[model samples]
Target: MSGETIYKGNKKILGLTTLSFFLTFVVWFNMAPFTSTIKEALNLSKEEIGVLMSINIALTIPARIIIGMLVDRFGPRKVYSSLLIVMSIPCFIFAFGTSFMQLFIARAFLGIIGAGFVIGIRMVSEWFPAKQVGLAEGIYGGWGNFGSAAAAFTLPTIALFIGGENGWRYAIALSGLLCLIYGFVYYRSVQDTPSGKVYERPKRNGAMEVTSYKSMAGLIFMTLPLYGILGLLTWKLSNTSLINSSLANTIYVILAVIYLYNVYKIWNVNKEHLKEGVDKKEQYSFRQVAILDFAYLITFGSELAVVSMLPMFFEETFELNIAQAGMVAASFAFMNLVARPGGGWLSDKFGRKKTLMILLLCLSVAYMGMSQINSSWPLVLAIILTMTCSFFVQAGEGSVFAMVPLVKKRLTGQVAGMVGAYGNVGGVLFLTVLSFVNPSLFFMTIGVAALLCFIASLFLKEPDTAEHSSIVVQDKAGKEAAM
Candidate 1:
């Protein structure tokens, strides 16, 4: 579709999908804004509160991977709508829970909704061509991501408006209700692709299809780190006495088994291709996907970690009140509204590889500057530095996905899924680093990681946009046709 046609013809789809993503995020992060209130009401310890927060993200690591496959198999429209509808159950459970276990189980279940972001990656890609996809995906992502800030800004006021100790409960439940209703609206409003276009399904659904044996090895090597991050999370919980040594060991064993099973799936899917070799035109490098994975790990990972801690960092460093600190910290997230789309626009105008490398370099430098902030620095200067850093960080995220759809059309959902999962892996890894070091050191760690990703991004191969192909077609007699 032409750019103007997209605005006129596909605008409704874009609007509805973006709103669906926004509502899912609101439900996914509903608890974060009211953590203190919940902690007070339950008489929970700091360790218990930490577990509750950790539980919010734990399942998302795997959920993104699973949802990616589902999107590819069932199509984004159905998968996304089903996710929102089903996840609302946990949201309601968490809203009413009076005990720690109830709250913990419900919060963990809510993590499944976090996978909603990957679904729209495929949906927006289906609607927009390679030339326009970066900007389209950026708008979907940048606007949808604002849901977290929306919850933070409005949910507390909503609770106050309800006026009672159970006010937080009602406010949380309201998000669930909105999510439940929007699920139906989204199902009715959107289709998997534009008119007369066939949705491409991956030949093998369980694991990504790699082009070569070397790439297969790289994919396996990369998969290990995801499991390692889970292991680290388990260790962290064990260290905090959240679980016993025996349970941690059992979880470790489970992860190892899952990893082995994934390897089998990868082999099962790609073994035939390894023997016969894929068509040169059909093959793309897994190295490109790996580099993007690392880039997102640093960009989105730091964003999640910084957003979680920046308010406290401001409060501690500037001796500002909690309210002032929170408002200042919020500027980081607020940058997503424009900066992400700007990054995507730059990627489309310039070359994708060049745009990504520049953003990563700027991100590394911005974080380095942030590492030097202290009590003596002006508060205005601190906020400026934070927002400046945020722009590059979020824009880097936009650039990463700008190329995602271009990688392999059929595997776009799975590719987006694995890359998106790495983002959560980065969050868990960076936040764990924060637990060991002070704020300044934590900032330095992120800066160092970004610098490394910049070097890795130098190896990325730009997606070929010389000719855009339509999806495979089927004839009336069940014969396959190429576009």
Candidate 2:
């Protein structure tokens, strides 16, 4: 195919996949905007409401890991479309749910929809050449991520226009309906890759293949935080009295056993390969993935944490009305549409490592500025700083993913999965910190973490090839050989 034809075809696939991602996000976070409405309708206690919020993210961490594996083994077309169609059931369930138990179950299941983000990383990487992959991934991510904001802004009005006690229910269900319709539309409209390009699956599927025992050990070390964050979530629920002490302890034990089993799976998958030794061409550093994990832990992780609280911060610090504060807070997320893509473009035009380092360093400084915001400071100035801080935070996220696909072609889904899971881990950890400290201290904590990530970024290696268009073909015996 000519370059021009490939470019034109890519635009269509990118748009379709990004739209799938956007609609999933819309359904994933649909409950958030209706928090108060649901509470009032259900006559729920504050603690129950808190539990609802907590469980909504509980499944997402593991879902991303599982979805990543599935995307690699099957293909994004099947996995993503199935994800959208299946998740819509939970969305509909939550929409009509009247009791805390019902809503809680629905929302918890809906968390799996968040895994849709990882599928797109693989899909976009497959379609766009390396030179343009960063910007393309950014557009997919940055635009799709806007769905949450879109839900927040549009859903309430949708409810009001429908105008009834069940208006919120109808509004939320509409998001579910979008998912249902789009699931079929997306499956029909897109392919796993362009017409001539073969979709590659990982050689092994249970766990990521590690080139060295050291890398295996590193994988085990990193897996700890994922389960540890789940433990933290359990602890939080225990404190809220959502789960009793005995139940929480039981959950803790179960989590530990599961973690150990996961470690065994990782070892089991990689042991043979490590014993024989991988060919030099196939060997890539686990350290690279580890670095990206922490980098995301700082960038997207902080964005999740700050977005949750910035409205309350503005409302209290400036004494603005709720509506006024929300509009101001929206500015932070508003940067995603531009800054994330700009970050990727920079990574493409400049260097990935250099762009990420600059963004993280500036992110640290921006948070330091945020940490100092007070009632004495003018609100306009504070909002300006907030937007600036958001630009770096989001752009850094774009930069991180821009390099994700380049790490290894076959492992893109699994790699994106682990890194994306860390972002949530960061969110949970940072929010836990917020629960213990003042807002200023929370900002300072993230600022300090960003500084550490900046130091880590210094070690990121650049991808050798600027474009990954080399073809991989399979012979009759079913072995892949790159051409």
Candidate 3:
């Protein structure tokens, strides 16, 4: 039998994948550094500023589910390019916003771009086969995630260099231009799959599928956090009090109803198939994917939450200049270019479960070390402690995706979307935790979450080779060479 002509797994795919993220990420975090300028220009309060920032991520959870389905149907190239064009208008509105409401709507529209990350995972999976997915995903995620840091480093510098009250608007508008130009360029250069192969779509959509009624039931339960996190953000608004709680109550009711419907839809779609039993499902377990999804919820989630707060915590606690503090906080993200790829390569080589277990343990230590920080402690030590935490943080990111591409072959996009969304959910919950808690405790709480997930990992079985066999595919080029 001839091996299939799967993705070329070549440099061209890598270049396109990186470029896709670079464009998407700039637009995603374009609001961060410029928030002060936006607030001052519009005469907004800190509370309003906080809401503006939160709104940017608000739409992404649902957007991922929607875009994931779309990507599986239409393919990544169309979905990503189209997302960039539509999202540019929001970037322009955000750049030139005259009021908090304008900024709020722009930020909400910006959530559309966050779904850009999902498109790449499916695209990258198409290019790189199973053996290399870990490293490819690591490179993709580590580089892609660093876009936030890019906004931090470049936007402020651009704002400063432009040397005027309106410098931020220019900086923000620059992102729109990048998105506009790159959208066209990306379309011209990339294909859904290399040469002749057709990109496969999933058998179902709406909710991720599980083989058993129990796991299907669990999948329904898992979706609650996505909505709960949104409600948690709603409460964080200053006017959102418990007594006038009709909106929150209504949202909760809607979420619960949606979840029940989702469970029914998942079961209805898969019930006949499950009764027939998995044709190839004698092997594999959805339980493993569920655990990893939660594991990532804590690991990558903590990373997002920590990175979100670290700059502010460091600035106030250490009494450092804003410049110095931001620089220090940035070390956490900069670790990604190395730490994440290292995690993927390590998992690919050593063992997936062992690497993740070891990293989670180290992550627990890093968080523990961070919780010990005080004004009396040396700054170098504190910095080292944060970077130590970052290594495991990014490594956990690598480990998570390492398993993502290895899950049920056909459902890889759906699985990646759920796991990816959990990372965002982690950010929301951790930052919400930070609202009432102190910084050290904030870091420690994440540690506690990681430890719980780590304990859960103790039950996770390393993915077996046969797991990929259900959707059988082979590399045609390899087969041709062999013949």
Candidate 4:
């Protein structure tokens, strides 16, 4: 298809997919806006509340990987629709949950919805060509990611409008209802690919395929950290007395076994390719994926941690009321609407590698400036600084995914999934650092991490659009046909 024709055809698909992703995030984070209400109503301890919060994100790491595989095999339209519809069940359960255990189980199940972001990565890549993909993905990500902030801003008013002690429950349920309805709407509205274009699938389903022995080894090494992060989470729960020692030990063993199983799958998936070696045209470096993973780890990860803490930081540092503090903290998230898209536009207009390197450098500098904020600083100046830092952080995220779809066309889902998971890993790691340190120190830690990512990003090779097609097409015989 011509660029103009493809652009016109994909407008509807982009709108629907972005909306679907927004709703999924709303449902996924529904509990956050009502945490205080739920705690008081259920008479939960602080530790229990902490556990509930942690559970909301715990499953998402592995879910992204599994959902990536599903999307690649079944197509994003079917898998995403199914995910939205099925996840609403848990949302409803959590909305009406009367006990801690019920809420725990529901939140854990709802974590899968967080994987919805991965679906749109593959979907947007399929629809847009390399020349335009960065901007398209930036729009999808920046706009869709605004859902969490939307939930935070709107759900409170929604609860007040319902006007009862159980109003929070109703507000939460409304998000689920929207999700259920949108599932059908999305399934009817979008196609997996443009007309006459074939959707490529990976040769194996269980694991990502690698091109060479070294790439295979790198893949395995990277996979280990995911399981390790889960282990760290379990250890934290045990240390807090959230789980018994025996249970924690059991979970650790299970995680180890799963890691071994994943290693085996990685070997199985790439063994033949390692022996025969893939064609130069077909092979892309796993190192590219790794660098993106680290890049996202700092960009999106710090975004998550900062958003969670910024409200309190503002309140304590500036002596502002809860309302004022929350408003200021929100500016960080609200930047997604423009900042993320701007990053993508820059990536498309300039070079991807240069855009990312510059953004990462600015990200580090922004955080370093943030680390110096204190009560002495003017409130307006602080807010401005916060928003400035947020721009680079989110734009860095835009730049990272802008290149993700270009890595390996068929494995785009899995690659996006792993990189997306590392973003969460960064969130967990940074937040954990916050638990033990002061706010200023926490910000500095993030700044330092961004600096390291910037250094690593120097090695990123820009995508050669002249040499590689943005989309991969296959013939009926399972051979690469066109791009």
Candidate 5:
């Protein structure tokens, strides 16, 4: 197909996939708007409310990894639809659950829906060529991510319109129902790829395949932080009284065993390929994946952490009312609509490595500047700094994923999963840091992390794509290739 024809035909599929992802996020974060209502209804303590907030993201880290593998195995069409339909069960349960345990269990399961982001990464890469995939993926990511903001803005008023003690419950359940119906619509509306195209499948499935034993070791080393972050979350649960100390200790031991078992699985999957060595044409550095992991940890990860705390930061630092503070803090997330896609377009115009390096360096500097904000600073200036810092942070995220699918076409799901999980790891760790320090130190810590990521980006090798086509086509050129 010609490039113009391809763009026209595939535009519909892109819209459908982005809409599916947007609805999933709408359900994933539906709980946030009703926090106050839920707290009042349940007569819960502040600590319990905090635990519920934390629970919403607890399952997402591992879910992304598992979902990534599933996307590669079953294709995004089936996986995305299935996830949407199945997660509705938990969404409805959280909406109407009466007890703390009920709400906790429901919210934890609902976290799996956050993995919807990875499925679309593979789907969009299939529809768009390598040259256009960055901006395409950026649109998928940026617009779909707006579901959270949409939920924040709309759900509360929706509940108010419905009116009554059950108003919030009904509002949330309505979103669940809509998402559930859209799951089937999405399944019928979209295919895995364009007509006559064969979807690429990885030869090995259970664990990620690494070409070299050195990369294999790096993969194992990187896996530790996923489990470590989970452990940190467990400790947070214990402190919040959501679980007893005994139960928390038991869970930690189980997590350790799971980590070791996972190590064995990684070895089992890659040992054969590593021992004999792979074909020269097929080999790619695993270090690229590792660097992107840290890159996302600081970028998207800090974005999550900051979004949660920024409202409070504004309220306290500038002595603004809750509404004013929320509006000002919202400038950070609001940047997603443009900044993320702009980052990807920059990567497409310039080189991917150069764009990512520049974004991370600016991100580091922006955060360092943010660390110096205080009551003495003008409120308008602080808001400007916040939005400016946010642009680099989100743009850095777009740049990271711009290279994820380029790593290994078949392993894109798993690669995206690992990199995406580290984003959450950054969130859990950074939030833990916030628990002990003030806002200034929190910003400084993230500044330092972004600087470290900037250093690591120096080692990222640009994908050698001299042999590939620069435009969309149907044959081998259609395969997800590096740039």
Candidate 6:
């Protein structure tokens, strides 16, 4: 019940949940390093490869929203476990994928697994008290996010050891094995919260409930990016530089209809709740969620996009070997363990708004350093820029989640899902931008986005009280609660 004891409980469960959540991400992006072999095996065109990469993230647009609801309804245990075991099937299928469509389908299914991060957001909230939740959530995010880097390090080596033209298959299969094992271990070892921690379930099922018409409009406005990012995916498919025009057109139509239908569905589901008379229930201010979403879109989103491309930038510019490039690029993620937790701790000791602004300013300077890179520059200087960029990149990540749990209690998972998805949305958006621009522009674009986030943070209202009293549905969880 005490803050320190609650954090101890949170730390224990977050550590375990982070393991499960991370495996899905590891296997999700495993294709990055192995794409060359896959393209050769399938005799695929460059356009097909682009489409293949795009498909891997295609389904996650809807999956995050749905998984958030499910975690809120059923708790993260069943959802997280089932996600792992189920994702492994695709990992294996992808390993042996003989045709382009086969790999595409498998990768698309894998996208849903990214939503695994959201479920743990709520789980972490239940275990930690308000004051410490930011640092707790940062650990969940920073550690779990490293799974991608793990895939970068170990997966290719596993493929090489298998020793064949089809070595990539062995690598992917090894990832599948990890998924299968972690699934059971997570299910068996972890509880949604400590035995003494309370689990809060949200009041409604379909969409986020808003307290007033003005906020409802704001909610609608916020969802526009979720759909717009999906539209970007469709546009990539249709682009002649990427995929076949005919198929892209079909996919575009499908995506457009899906977005429209999602808006309609969420509007209908929450229509009654949106009415002022239905409930005077207040959620986190629309402004807060919006600010956080933009912050994450810049911070986490930049990390995702930059990481995806860093290896290539190094290899081409400095003429480093692929392995060397990957190692250097991956040093950015190394900051995750310390920087993310440091961000949260700083926000707790200082103030959330001040901490976020400082990090955002640091990020702007970091981008300036990154933009200066050229073939003539010393490699050490480049590494310093990367490490410097990484500190702000990860510290900003820490600050965002530090604010997440304090919003509304029960909806932490959904809130986290939207924010997390925006990170992916940022990935898709920034990557798409890369398709049009140069690498320097890439760094500059992120710098501009971070500046926007800095301005947005000024609009955020800090939580003045320890708890925001919203109705938490008392089920079996209430009995176990230390609170």
TM-score of 5: 0.96
Residue lDDT tens for model 5, 1-483: 554545455778779999988898889889888898899998988888888889888899999999999999999999999999999999899888999989989989999999999999998877777777778788888889889998888899999999999999998998899889999999999898766456778888788888998999999999999999999999988876568999999999999999999999999998888888799878989999999999999999999999989999999988999999889767788899898888888887787899999999999999999999999999889988999999999888888878888888778899999898889889888999999999999999999989988999999998753422233235665554322
Between prediction 1 and prediction 6, which has the larger lDDT?
Answer: 1
Per-residue CA lDDT of model 4 for 78-180, tens digit only, reads 9999999999999999999999999999999999999999999999988888888899999999999999988988998999999999999999999999999
lDDT tens digits by residue: candidate 3, 56-121: 888888787778778877888888888887788989988888877788888998987887887888
What is the per-residue lDDT of model 6 for residues 1-483, given as tens digits with 9 covering 90 to 100?
A: 444553455556877888886787798889988888888889999888888888888778678888988888888988898889988998899889999888888888988888888888888777766667678778888888888878877888988888888888888888888889888888887777654445677777778766666766777788888877777777766665655678777776877787677677667867776653553345457677778888988888898899889999999999999889988877888889888988887877787778988998789778866877899999888988899899998999999888877777777778888888888899999998998898998898888778777877888888642554221333464443323
What is the lDDT, from 0 to 100, of the residue 169 in candidate 1?
98
lDDT per residue (tens digit) for residues 1-483 in model 1: 333433344667778899988998899889888988999999998999999889888899889889999999999999999998999999999999999999999999999899999999999888877788898888999999999999988999999999899999999999999999989889988899865467889888789889999999999999998898889989999987679999999999999999999999998999997899789888889999899899989989999999989989999999999989988878888899999988888898897999999999999999999999999999899889999999999999999989999898888998999999999999999998998999999999999999999999888988876554444445577665545
Candidate number with the higher TM-score (4 or 6): 4
What would you estimate as the lDDT of candidate 6?
0.80
Q: Report the Cα lDDT for residue 6, model 2.
A: 50
Candidate 1 runs further than 4 Å off: 1-8, 469-483
What's the lDDT for residue 389 in model 6? Answer: 91
Show where candidate 6 strays beyond 4 Å: 1-8, 241-246, 276-281, 468-483
Of the two candidates 1 and 2, the one with more favorable TM-score, higher being better, is 2
List the candidates' TM-scores in order.
Answer: 0.96, 0.97, 0.91, 0.97, 0.96, 0.91
Judging by lDDT, tell me the better candidate of 4 and 6: 4
Query: Which wins on TM-score, candidate 3 or candidate 5?
Result: 5
